[model samples]
Target: MAADSRAARPLQKMFSEVPATYDLINRLFTLRLDQAWRKIAAKECMRENPRLVLDLCTGTGDLALSMAGQARPGMHIAAVDFSLPMLLEGRLKFVAPGQRVGFVLGDVGKLPFREGSFDAIGIAFAFRNLVYKNRERDKYLSEILRVLSPGGKLVIVETSRPRSPLVRLLFHWYMRTAVSFLAGLISGRGAAYKYLAHSAINFYSSGDLSDLLESAGFRRVQYRTFLFGVCALHLAYREGPGNMENS
Candidate 1:
Protein backbone atom coordinates (compact mmCIF):
# COMPACT_ATOMS: atom_id res chain seq x y z
CA MET A 1 0.00 0.00 0.00
CA ALA A 2 1.15 3.51 -0.75
CA ALA A 3 2.29 5.64 2.19
CA ASP A 4 -0.12 8.38 1.25
CA SER A 5 -2.96 5.98 1.84
CA ARG A 6 -2.03 6.23 5.49
CA ALA A 7 -1.09 9.89 5.26
CA ALA A 8 -4.69 10.95 5.62
CA ARG A 9 -5.24 9.62 9.11
CA PRO A 10 -2.05 11.02 10.60
CA LEU A 11 -2.54 14.36 8.90
CA GLN A 12 -6.05 14.53 10.30
CA LYS A 13 -4.80 13.75 13.76
CA MET A 14 -2.01 16.32 13.54
CA PHE A 15 -4.37 19.09 12.47
CA SER A 16 -6.97 18.28 15.09
CA GLU A 17 -4.42 18.99 17.80
CA VAL A 18 -3.52 22.50 16.67
CA PRO A 19 -6.81 24.33 16.16
CA ALA A 20 -6.35 26.53 19.22
CA THR A 21 -3.19 28.19 17.90
CA TYR A 22 -3.37 27.52 14.19
CA ASP A 23 -4.68 30.94 13.31
CA LEU A 24 -2.35 32.75 15.65
CA ILE A 25 0.74 30.92 14.47
CA ASN A 26 -0.23 31.63 10.87
CA ARG A 27 -0.58 35.32 11.59
CA LEU A 28 2.75 35.35 13.34
CA PHE A 29 4.65 33.37 10.74
CA THR A 30 3.40 35.34 7.80
CA LEU A 31 3.09 38.65 9.59
CA ARG A 32 -0.64 38.47 8.99
CA LEU A 33 -0.08 38.29 5.25
CA ASP A 34 -2.08 35.06 5.06
CA GLN A 35 -5.36 36.90 5.41
CA ALA A 36 -4.44 39.15 2.51
CA TRP A 37 -3.53 36.12 0.44
CA ARG A 38 -6.87 34.47 1.23
CA LYS A 39 -8.67 37.61 0.17
CA ILE A 40 -6.95 37.33 -3.18
CA ALA A 41 -8.07 33.72 -3.51
CA ALA A 42 -11.55 34.84 -2.51
CA LYS A 43 -11.54 37.49 -5.25
CA GLU A 44 -10.59 34.84 -7.77
CA CYS A 45 -13.41 32.64 -6.49
CA MET A 46 -15.94 35.43 -7.01
CA ARG A 47 -14.48 36.92 -10.19
CA GLU A 48 -16.78 34.83 -12.39
CA ASN A 49 -19.79 35.50 -10.20
CA PRO A 50 -20.12 31.87 -9.24
CA ARG A 51 -23.41 30.85 -7.63
CA LEU A 52 -21.87 28.14 -5.48
CA VAL A 53 -18.37 28.07 -4.05
CA LEU A 54 -16.59 25.34 -2.12
CA ASP A 55 -13.67 26.04 0.18
CA LEU A 56 -11.67 22.86 -0.06
CA CYS A 57 -9.75 21.82 3.06
CA THR A 58 -10.91 24.89 4.83
CA GLY A 59 -8.71 24.76 7.94
CA THR A 60 -10.05 27.21 10.49
CA GLY A 61 -12.39 28.57 7.79
CA ASP A 62 -10.27 31.64 7.17
CA LEU A 63 -10.68 31.39 3.42
CA ALA A 64 -14.41 30.77 3.70
CA LEU A 65 -14.90 33.71 6.02
CA SER A 66 -12.92 35.87 3.63
CA MET A 67 -15.13 34.69 0.79
CA ALA A 68 -18.28 35.27 2.84
CA GLY A 69 -17.39 38.90 3.29
CA GLN A 70 -17.33 39.39 -0.46
CA ALA A 71 -19.84 36.81 -1.59
CA ARG A 72 -22.84 38.14 -3.44
CA PRO A 73 -26.21 38.06 -1.78
CA GLY A 74 -27.76 34.61 -2.06
CA MET A 75 -24.48 33.01 -3.04
CA HIS A 76 -23.77 29.78 -1.21
CA ILE A 77 -20.46 28.71 0.32
CA ALA A 78 -19.56 25.24 1.58
CA ALA A 79 -16.40 24.71 3.60
CA VAL A 80 -15.11 21.21 4.31
CA ASP A 81 -12.29 19.77 6.39
CA PHE A 82 -11.55 16.38 7.88
CA SER A 83 -10.49 17.80 11.23
CA LEU A 84 -13.46 18.54 13.46
CA PRO A 85 -11.56 20.85 15.80
CA MET A 86 -10.44 23.02 12.92
CA LEU A 87 -13.99 23.27 11.63
CA LEU A 88 -15.23 24.26 15.08
CA GLU A 89 -12.57 26.92 15.36
CA GLY A 90 -13.53 28.30 11.99
CA ARG A 91 -17.21 28.38 12.94
CA LEU A 92 -16.47 30.67 15.85
CA LYS A 93 -14.98 33.30 13.55
CA PHE A 94 -17.78 33.12 11.00
CA VAL A 95 -20.06 36.13 11.31
CA ALA A 96 -21.16 37.04 7.84
CA PRO A 97 -24.74 38.20 8.10
CA GLY A 98 -26.92 37.63 5.05
CA GLN A 99 -24.16 35.57 3.48
CA ARG A 100 -24.63 31.84 3.26
CA VAL A 101 -21.83 29.67 4.62
CA GLY A 102 -22.00 26.04 5.65
CA PHE A 103 -19.27 24.05 7.38
CA VAL A 104 -19.07 20.32 6.77
CA LEU A 105 -16.78 17.81 8.45
CA GLY A 106 -15.52 15.31 5.89
CA ASP A 107 -12.53 14.02 4.06
CA VAL A 108 -11.48 15.76 0.86
CA GLY A 109 -10.79 12.43 -0.82
CA LYS A 110 -14.51 11.72 -0.89
CA LEU A 111 -16.49 14.92 -0.96
CA PRO A 112 -20.18 14.33 -0.28
CA PHE A 113 -21.54 16.23 -3.19
CA ARG A 114 -23.10 15.57 -6.56
CA GLU A 115 -21.23 15.84 -9.82
CA GLY A 116 -20.82 19.37 -11.11
CA SER A 117 -21.95 20.81 -7.81
CA PHE A 118 -19.86 23.90 -7.38
CA ASP A 119 -19.25 26.66 -9.90
CA ALA A 120 -15.90 27.46 -8.32
CA ILE A 121 -13.58 26.05 -5.66
CA GLY A 122 -10.83 27.66 -3.61
CA ILE A 123 -8.17 26.17 -1.38
CA ALA A 124 -5.60 27.96 0.72
CA PHE A 125 -2.27 26.35 1.67
CA ALA A 126 -3.78 22.87 1.75
CA PHE A 127 -3.05 21.98 -1.84
CA ARG A 128 0.26 20.34 -0.97
CA ASN A 129 -1.21 17.62 1.24
CA LEU A 130 -3.47 16.53 -1.60
CA VAL A 131 -0.80 16.49 -4.27
CA TYR A 132 2.80 16.30 -3.05
CA LYS A 133 3.84 12.64 -3.00
CA ASN A 134 0.29 11.61 -2.17
CA ARG A 135 -0.38 8.20 -3.71
CA GLU A 136 -4.05 9.13 -3.99
CA ARG A 137 -3.32 12.30 -5.92
CA ASP A 138 -5.32 11.25 -8.94
CA LYS A 139 -8.31 10.29 -6.86
CA TYR A 140 -8.40 13.58 -5.01
CA LEU A 141 -7.86 15.65 -8.15
CA SER A 142 -10.52 13.72 -9.99
CA GLU A 143 -12.96 14.21 -7.15
CA ILE A 144 -12.36 17.97 -7.34
CA LEU A 145 -12.87 17.94 -11.06
CA ARG A 146 -15.94 15.80 -10.67
CA VAL A 147 -17.70 18.26 -8.38
CA LEU A 148 -16.90 21.33 -10.46
CA SER A 149 -19.51 22.41 -12.96
CA PRO A 150 -18.65 22.90 -16.58
CA GLY A 151 -16.54 25.97 -17.22
CA GLY A 152 -15.97 26.17 -13.49
CA LYS A 153 -12.74 27.34 -11.92
CA LEU A 154 -10.52 26.05 -9.11
CA VAL A 155 -8.46 28.65 -7.31
CA ILE A 156 -5.44 27.83 -5.18
CA VAL A 157 -3.15 29.80 -2.90
CA GLU A 158 -0.16 27.81 -1.67
CA THR A 159 3.52 27.86 -0.81
CA SER A 160 5.88 27.65 -3.77
CA ARG A 161 9.56 26.88 -4.20
CA PRO A 162 11.46 30.06 -4.81
CA ARG A 163 13.03 30.44 -8.24
CA SER A 164 16.39 31.79 -7.19
CA PRO A 165 18.85 29.37 -5.67
CA LEU A 166 20.18 31.74 -3.03
CA VAL A 167 16.77 32.93 -1.90
CA ARG A 168 15.53 29.38 -1.99
CA LEU A 169 18.28 28.29 0.36
CA LEU A 170 17.55 31.14 2.73
CA PHE A 171 13.82 30.45 2.67
CA HIS A 172 14.31 26.75 3.21
CA TRP A 173 16.63 27.41 6.13
CA TYR A 174 14.10 29.74 7.70
CA MET A 175 11.29 27.28 7.20
CA ARG A 176 13.25 24.41 8.66
CA THR A 177 14.56 26.42 11.56
CA ALA A 178 12.59 29.47 12.66
CA VAL A 179 9.23 28.44 11.27
CA SER A 180 9.44 24.94 12.62
CA PHE A 181 10.70 25.94 16.04
CA LEU A 182 8.47 28.97 16.53
CA ALA A 183 5.29 27.28 15.28
CA GLY A 184 5.96 24.27 17.48
CA LEU A 185 6.74 26.48 20.42
CA ILE A 186 3.61 28.55 19.97
CA SER A 187 1.23 25.77 18.99
CA GLY A 188 2.78 23.08 21.19
CA ARG A 189 2.45 20.74 18.24
CA GLY A 190 6.03 20.16 17.27
CA ALA A 191 5.38 17.25 15.01
CA ALA A 192 2.77 19.12 13.03
CA TYR A 193 5.01 22.15 12.55
CA LYS A 194 7.85 19.84 11.66
CA TYR A 195 5.69 18.33 8.96
CA LEU A 196 4.65 21.80 7.84
CA ALA A 197 8.24 22.91 7.56
CA HIS A 198 9.26 19.78 5.68
CA SER A 199 6.35 20.00 3.29
CA ALA A 200 6.72 23.66 2.44
CA ILE A 201 10.45 23.38 1.97
CA ASN A 202 10.08 20.62 -0.60
CA PHE A 203 6.81 21.53 -2.37
CA TYR A 204 6.51 22.16 -6.10
CA SER A 205 7.41 25.26 -8.04
CA SER A 206 5.03 27.52 -9.94
CA GLY A 207 5.84 25.99 -13.31
CA ASP A 208 5.52 22.47 -11.97
CA LEU A 209 2.13 23.29 -10.52
CA SER A 210 0.93 24.63 -13.89
CA ASP A 211 1.93 21.42 -15.57
CA LEU A 212 0.33 19.34 -12.86
CA LEU A 213 -2.99 21.15 -13.22
CA GLU A 214 -2.92 21.02 -17.00
CA SER A 215 -2.19 17.32 -17.01
CA ALA A 216 -5.02 16.79 -14.56
CA GLY A 217 -7.43 18.05 -17.29
CA PHE A 218 -7.73 21.65 -16.33
CA ARG A 219 -8.23 23.22 -19.76
CA ARG A 220 -6.11 26.21 -18.83
CA VAL A 221 -3.93 27.18 -15.89
CA GLN A 222 -2.73 30.60 -14.82
CA TYR A 223 -0.31 31.48 -12.02
CA ARG A 224 0.67 34.54 -10.02
CA THR A 225 3.63 34.73 -7.70
CA PHE A 226 3.87 36.45 -4.34
CA LEU A 227 6.76 37.31 -2.00
CA PHE A 228 9.26 36.58 -4.75
CA GLY A 229 7.88 33.18 -5.63
CA VAL A 230 7.52 31.94 -2.06
CA CYS A 231 3.77 31.64 -2.62
CA ALA A 232 1.57 31.21 -5.68
CA LEU A 233 -2.03 31.55 -6.77
CA HIS A 234 -3.24 29.13 -9.39
CA LEU A 235 -6.39 29.51 -11.46
CA ALA A 236 -7.45 26.30 -13.15
CA TYR A 237 -10.44 26.01 -15.43
CA ARG A 238 -12.64 23.14 -16.42
CA GLU A 239 -13.84 22.92 -19.99
CA GLY A 240 -16.57 25.35 -20.87
CA PRO A 241 -20.12 24.44 -19.95
CA GLY A 242 -21.75 22.22 -22.57
CA ASN A 243 -18.38 21.14 -23.93
CA MET A 244 -17.96 24.44 -25.70
CA GLU A 245 -14.34 25.31 -26.38
CA ASN A 246 -13.12 28.15 -24.20
CA SER A 247 -11.22 30.63 -26.24
Candidate 2:
Protein backbone atom coordinates (compact mmCIF):
# COMPACT_ATOMS: atom_id res chain seq x y z
CA MET A 1 0.00 0.00 0.00
CA ALA A 2 1.16 3.50 -0.80
CA ALA A 3 1.90 5.78 2.09
CA ASP A 4 -0.94 8.10 1.28
CA SER A 5 -3.39 5.24 0.85
CA ARG A 6 -2.29 3.60 4.04
CA ALA A 7 -2.69 6.90 5.79
CA ALA A 8 -6.10 7.57 4.31
CA ARG A 9 -7.75 4.21 4.77
CA PRO A 10 -9.58 3.44 7.98
CA LEU A 11 -7.45 1.59 10.54
CA GLN A 12 -9.72 -1.45 10.30
CA LYS A 13 -9.18 -1.74 6.58
CA MET A 14 -5.40 -1.75 6.82
CA PHE A 15 -5.35 -4.08 9.77
CA SER A 16 -7.74 -6.53 8.15
CA GLU A 17 -5.79 -6.43 4.93
CA VAL A 18 -2.68 -7.43 6.80
CA PRO A 19 -4.18 -9.56 9.56
CA ALA A 20 -2.64 -12.83 8.45
CA THR A 21 0.88 -11.37 8.42
CA TYR A 22 0.53 -8.99 11.32
CA ASP A 23 2.18 -11.07 14.05
CA LEU A 24 5.03 -12.28 11.88
CA ILE A 25 5.78 -8.79 10.66
CA ASN A 26 5.57 -7.40 14.18
CA ARG A 27 8.05 -9.91 15.61
CA LEU A 28 10.49 -9.59 12.74
CA PHE A 29 10.39 -5.81 12.67
CA THR A 30 10.88 -5.48 16.40
CA LEU A 31 13.50 -8.20 16.55
CA ARG A 32 11.26 -9.86 19.15
CA LEU A 33 11.79 -6.97 21.59
CA ASP A 34 8.05 -6.36 21.35
CA GLN A 35 7.42 -9.26 23.71
CA ALA A 36 9.64 -7.83 26.43
CA TRP A 37 8.07 -4.41 26.02
CA ARG A 38 4.56 -5.84 26.37
CA LYS A 39 5.58 -7.76 29.49
CA ILE A 40 6.82 -4.59 31.15
CA ALA A 41 3.67 -2.70 30.16
CA ALA A 42 1.49 -5.52 31.47
CA LYS A 43 3.28 -5.53 34.81
CA GLU A 44 2.95 -1.80 35.19
CA CYS A 45 -0.69 -1.82 34.10
CA MET A 46 -1.43 -4.43 36.75
CA ARG A 47 0.08 -2.21 39.46
CA GLU A 48 -3.25 -0.49 40.04
CA ASN A 49 -4.75 -3.90 40.94
CA PRO A 50 -7.54 -3.59 38.44
CA ARG A 51 -10.56 -5.89 38.51
CA LEU A 52 -11.65 -5.12 34.96
CA VAL A 53 -9.18 -3.98 32.29
CA LEU A 54 -9.50 -2.60 28.79
CA ASP A 55 -6.87 -3.22 26.12
CA LEU A 56 -7.46 -0.72 23.35
CA CYS A 57 -6.26 -1.52 19.86
CA THR A 58 -5.69 -5.04 21.03
CA GLY A 59 -4.17 -6.43 17.85
CA THR A 60 -4.04 -10.21 18.08
CA GLY A 61 -4.56 -9.73 21.83
CA ASP A 62 -0.86 -10.03 22.69
CA LEU A 63 -0.85 -7.25 25.25
CA ALA A 64 -4.27 -8.27 26.53
CA LEU A 65 -3.05 -11.80 27.08
CA SER A 66 -0.11 -10.47 29.05
CA MET A 67 -2.38 -8.21 31.07
CA ALA A 68 -4.74 -11.12 31.75
CA GLY A 69 -1.88 -13.21 33.12
CA GLN A 70 -0.86 -10.38 35.46
CA ALA A 71 -4.37 -9.64 36.68
CA ARG A 72 -6.20 -11.93 39.09
CA PRO A 73 -6.91 -15.30 37.49
CA GLY A 74 -10.63 -14.60 36.94
CA MET A 75 -10.29 -10.95 36.08
CA HIS A 76 -12.10 -9.82 32.92
CA ILE A 77 -10.57 -7.97 30.02
CA ALA A 78 -12.33 -6.10 27.22
CA ALA A 79 -9.96 -6.40 24.28
CA VAL A 80 -11.29 -4.28 21.47
CA ASP A 81 -10.24 -3.33 17.95
CA PHE A 82 -11.94 -2.13 14.80
CA SER A 83 -10.69 -4.98 12.68
CA LEU A 84 -12.90 -8.02 12.99
CA PRO A 85 -10.50 -10.19 11.00
CA MET A 86 -7.68 -9.42 13.36
CA LEU A 87 -9.97 -10.03 16.32
CA LEU A 88 -11.06 -13.35 14.92
CA GLU A 89 -7.49 -14.40 14.29
CA GLY A 90 -6.63 -13.42 17.85
CA ARG A 91 -9.66 -15.22 19.26
CA LEU A 92 -8.55 -18.54 17.86
CA LYS A 93 -5.48 -18.51 20.07
CA PHE A 94 -7.33 -18.51 23.41
CA VAL A 95 -10.46 -20.21 24.72
CA ALA A 96 -11.64 -17.47 27.05
CA PRO A 97 -15.34 -17.04 27.60
CA GLY A 98 -16.84 -13.64 28.42
CA GLN A 99 -16.26 -14.34 32.09
CA ARG A 100 -12.51 -13.99 31.68
CA VAL A 101 -11.68 -12.42 28.33
CA GLY A 102 -13.92 -10.89 25.69
CA PHE A 103 -13.13 -9.43 22.28
CA VAL A 104 -15.07 -6.60 20.69
CA LEU A 105 -14.88 -4.81 17.37
CA GLY A 106 -14.59 -1.12 18.00
CA ASP A 107 -12.32 1.79 17.26
CA VAL A 108 -10.08 3.03 20.02
CA GLY A 109 -10.65 6.66 19.03
CA LYS A 110 -14.36 6.19 19.66
CA LEU A 111 -14.61 3.61 22.39
CA PRO A 112 -18.09 2.34 23.27
CA PHE A 113 -18.45 2.44 27.04
CA ARG A 114 -19.56 4.51 29.97
CA GLU A 115 -17.61 6.73 32.35
CA GLY A 116 -15.35 5.10 34.93
CA SER A 117 -16.07 1.78 33.29
CA PHE A 118 -12.69 0.12 33.62
CA ASP A 119 -10.08 -0.09 36.35
CA ALA A 120 -7.26 0.32 33.83
CA ILE A 121 -6.75 0.76 30.08
CA GLY A 122 -3.70 -0.19 28.05
CA ILE A 123 -2.43 0.68 24.58
CA ALA A 124 0.75 -0.88 23.23
CA PHE A 125 2.28 0.21 19.94
CA ALA A 126 -1.27 1.13 18.94
CA PHE A 127 -1.53 4.84 19.73
CA ARG A 128 0.48 5.98 16.75
CA ASN A 129 -1.44 3.64 14.51
CA LEU A 130 -4.65 5.51 15.28
CA VAL A 131 -5.98 7.66 12.43
CA TYR A 132 -5.47 11.05 13.93
CA LYS A 133 -5.95 13.59 11.14
CA ASN A 134 -6.41 16.73 13.18
CA ARG A 135 -7.66 17.76 16.62
CA GLU A 136 -9.95 14.75 16.40
CA ARG A 137 -7.24 12.80 18.17
CA ASP A 138 -7.98 14.76 21.31
CA LYS A 139 -11.40 13.14 21.47
CA TYR A 140 -9.76 9.76 21.56
CA LEU A 141 -7.58 10.75 24.46
CA SER A 142 -10.55 12.26 26.21
CA GLU A 143 -12.54 9.08 25.65
CA ILE A 144 -9.80 7.17 27.41
CA LEU A 145 -10.02 9.59 30.30
CA ARG A 146 -13.79 9.31 30.45
CA VAL A 147 -13.75 5.53 30.50
CA LEU A 148 -11.16 5.20 33.24
CA SER A 149 -12.26 4.99 36.84
CA PRO A 150 -11.01 7.58 39.26
CA GLY A 151 -7.64 6.32 40.56
CA GLY A 152 -7.38 3.95 37.62
CA LYS A 153 -4.19 3.75 35.58
CA LEU A 154 -3.38 4.02 31.90
CA VAL A 155 -0.26 2.29 30.52
CA ILE A 156 1.28 2.95 27.11
CA VAL A 157 4.07 0.95 25.47
CA GLU A 158 5.63 2.29 22.30
CA THR A 159 8.98 2.65 20.53
CA SER A 160 11.19 5.70 20.88
CA ARG A 161 14.44 6.94 19.48
CA PRO A 162 17.62 6.38 21.46
CA ARG A 163 19.24 9.53 22.85
CA SER A 164 22.86 8.49 22.50
CA PRO A 165 24.20 9.94 19.25
CA LEU A 166 26.31 6.99 18.09
CA VAL A 167 23.77 4.39 19.17
CA ARG A 168 20.89 6.22 17.52
CA LEU A 169 22.80 6.51 14.27
CA LEU A 170 23.45 2.76 14.19
CA PHE A 171 19.89 1.91 15.18
CA HIS A 172 18.50 4.11 12.46
CA TRP A 173 20.67 2.50 9.84
CA TYR A 174 19.70 -1.00 10.95
CA MET A 175 16.00 -0.16 10.90
CA ARG A 176 16.23 1.45 7.49
CA THR A 177 18.21 -1.34 5.96
CA ALA A 178 18.37 -4.80 7.55
CA VAL A 179 15.10 -4.74 9.48
CA SER A 180 13.02 -3.59 6.53
CA PHE A 181 14.59 -6.20 4.28
CA LEU A 182 13.95 -9.07 6.67
CA ALA A 183 10.40 -7.96 7.40
CA GLY A 184 9.65 -7.67 3.70
CA LEU A 185 10.96 -11.15 3.05
CA ILE A 186 8.81 -12.77 5.71
CA SER A 187 5.62 -10.69 5.55
CA GLY A 188 5.74 -9.43 1.95
CA ARG A 189 5.12 -5.97 3.29
CA GLY A 190 8.59 -4.43 3.40
CA ALA A 191 7.08 -1.02 2.84
CA ALA A 192 4.85 -1.39 5.87
CA TYR A 193 7.88 -2.37 7.92
CA LYS A 194 9.66 0.65 6.56
CA TYR A 195 6.81 2.82 7.77
CA LEU A 196 6.90 1.04 11.11
CA ALA A 197 10.51 2.06 11.60
CA HIS A 198 9.69 5.58 10.56
CA SER A 199 6.71 5.72 12.92
CA ALA A 200 8.87 4.66 15.87
CA ILE A 201 11.34 7.45 15.28
CA ASN A 202 8.56 9.95 14.59
CA PHE A 203 6.41 9.09 17.64
CA TYR A 204 6.46 11.27 20.73
CA SER A 205 9.33 11.29 23.18
CA SER A 206 8.70 9.99 26.71
CA GLY A 207 8.50 13.51 28.13
CA ASP A 208 6.30 14.90 25.38
CA LEU A 209 3.83 12.06 25.69
CA SER A 210 3.75 12.45 29.47
CA ASP A 211 2.73 16.04 28.94
CA LEU A 212 -0.05 14.91 26.61
CA LEU A 213 -1.29 12.53 29.29
CA GLU A 214 -1.38 15.38 31.78
CA SER A 215 -3.27 17.51 29.29
CA ALA A 216 -5.77 14.68 28.99
CA GLY A 217 -6.50 15.03 32.76
CA PHE A 218 -4.24 12.32 34.05
CA ARG A 219 -2.10 13.07 37.11
CA ARG A 220 1.16 11.84 38.57
CA VAL A 221 2.35 10.66 35.16
CA GLN A 222 5.71 8.85 34.95
CA TYR A 223 7.65 7.03 32.24
CA ARG A 224 10.33 4.36 32.02
CA THR A 225 12.69 3.96 29.06
CA PHE A 226 13.92 0.58 27.98
CA LEU A 227 16.32 -0.95 25.43
CA PHE A 228 18.58 2.05 25.92
CA GLY A 229 15.73 4.38 25.03
CA VAL A 230 14.63 2.39 22.01
CA CYS A 231 11.27 1.90 23.73
CA ALA A 232 9.26 3.69 26.45
CA LEU A 233 6.60 2.66 28.96
CA HIS A 234 4.35 5.50 30.17
CA LEU A 235 2.23 5.27 33.31
CA ALA A 236 -0.46 7.78 34.17
CA TYR A 237 -3.33 7.67 36.62
CA ARG A 238 -6.82 9.14 36.74
CA GLU A 239 -7.24 11.41 39.73
CA GLY A 240 -9.52 10.22 42.47
CA PRO A 241 -11.81 12.26 44.71
CA GLY A 242 -9.26 12.37 47.53
CA ASN A 243 -5.69 13.60 47.46
CA MET A 244 -3.75 11.81 44.75
CA GLU A 245 -0.64 9.81 45.52
CA ASN A 246 2.43 11.49 44.05
CA SER A 247 4.01 8.25 42.96
Specify the highest-TM-score model's number: 1
Give candidate 2's whole-model lDDT: 0.75
> Which residue pairs clash within candidate 2?
none
For all candidates, the clash counts are: 0, 0
Give the residue spans of candidate 2 off by over 4 A.
Answer: 1-8, 96-99, 131-135, 242-247
Residue 69 local lDDT, model 2 = 70
Q: Which pairs clash inside model 1?
A: none
Q: TM-scores for all candidates?
A: 0.93, 0.86
Model 1, runs deviating above 4 Å: 1-8, 242-247
Q: Pick the candidate with the highest lDDT.
A: 1
lDDT at 45 for candidate 2?
69
lDDT of 2 by residue, 1-247 (tens): 0011223344456567667888877787677889889988888767756677898888788998888777776567888877777788877767765335678777656677889888888888887775223346787888888888888888888876677878778877877776666766676766666666676656676788788789878988998898788788888888995222333
- Local distance difference test, each candidate: 0.88, 0.75
